[model samples]
Target: MVVDTEPRMLKHQVVRKSLDSLLEGMSPGDPFPSERDLADAHDVSRETLRQAIRELLVAGRIERRGRTTVVAAPKVVLPLAIGSYTEAAREKGMSATRILVGWSTYSADAELAELLHIDTGAPVVQLERVFTTDDTRVGLETTRIPADRIPGLIETFDYRTSLYAELRTRGIIFGPVVDTIETVLPDAREAALLTVDTRTPMFLLNRTSYDDQGVPIEQRRSLYRGDRMTFTAVMGA
Candidate 1:
């Protein structure tokens, strides 16, 4: 809702920011002050406070909890495997927002060229991103796409969309992935970006996606929050 800057606008801004913080799940149901207390703190009239609360209720951002109120939304649980990040996120009704921190062509180092089965110094597009769940940052990924094969990648869609789908439309495929993961200590940048302090660790998943002809098309490294994610892998006897 585009709220106009009316005479009673400060209270609305306070409510909006507070509701957004609530949806971030910082507090479950223990945060919203009472009607009278909020009115006192914000220096607004009780009627004004009531109106702001009503707006939040209409927006579905909060609900009554016991005698008080609590945030209404929960983080989504997106299942991952076999499909692309965008695919898994979309399947679970997430918006799949991406912040493209890095996007450029690099000459593949020896290790990278070997992984993609290309000559050393072949052009590769590297993309680093943080993906969010409900506008809250949840995961970080650094991916490399071999350039000659994916030709003109930047000219096409926005960097944040489903690259796998785009590639399929161009008759390219990364058939299935072989992945491994380990619990890792977060570097400073990763910790800051993922909203985890140094004391908290992340699960680092390194994946190599291959084509039907056994060619590697993309290699990705992702760091996911340890508290928010669980992995379920089927086993073969």
Candidate 2:
């Protein structure tokens, strides 16, 4: 059962907690307990149970898809500091899967060449993926790694748990990223995966990640759902 802190944050904390208990680790499309059964177990009215379920749906904790309320994997955090997506998700008790869309060795296009600080025709490894939580696609990412600096990285690192963690273990440190964030319309495929309409605005984040020597190592473009996700940051002088 996913018991996030402050169930009281929503109106029906008791009912929500009960439902969370029932849905934990259950597969998508599994039958949620009947309304009467849930009401009996939680000692609440059926209307209250329905209200709690709606809140869970909004929080992306449990989906009210076709047949049942499916438990969702935990959300990911995009820290202002450097962190790995897989590590962050695992820390919150969720599994992280990386799909290697594939790699390429090609001439850099104008904008990409500028972003990666590489000469045109430089070899690059392009990685693409959709990040999921409990089988629900939450974000889409495309990352480009400059090929010269890290040859054969894909052979070992493909589908690794956390790319940034592995890089650190290899004595590679990434400096702070310079990122630009905007909201834009999702394309057809993105809309389908994110379960939103194409017209619904999605967050577009373009980031250039560098190394200690001020050499760009990774260029990344990410799209997140505005409705289902939020990011947190901390800054201090």
Evaluated against the true structure, the overall lDDT of model 2 is: 0.71
Give a tens-digit lDDT track for model 2, residues 1-237: 988786445547767876777677586556667778877877778888888876666566654455544555444555545776666766777766655455566668877888888887777887777777555567788888888777777777755466677667778877778989898889998787666557545779888888888888788888986545668878789
Q: Count the backbone clashes (under 3 Å) in each candidate.
A: 0, 0
Question: What lDDT does each candidate get?
Answer: 0.74, 0.71
Clashes of 2: 0
RMSD of 2: 8.2
Residue 216 alpha-carbon offset, candidate 2, angstroms: 0.6
TM-score for each predicted model, relative to the true structure:
0.66, 0.66
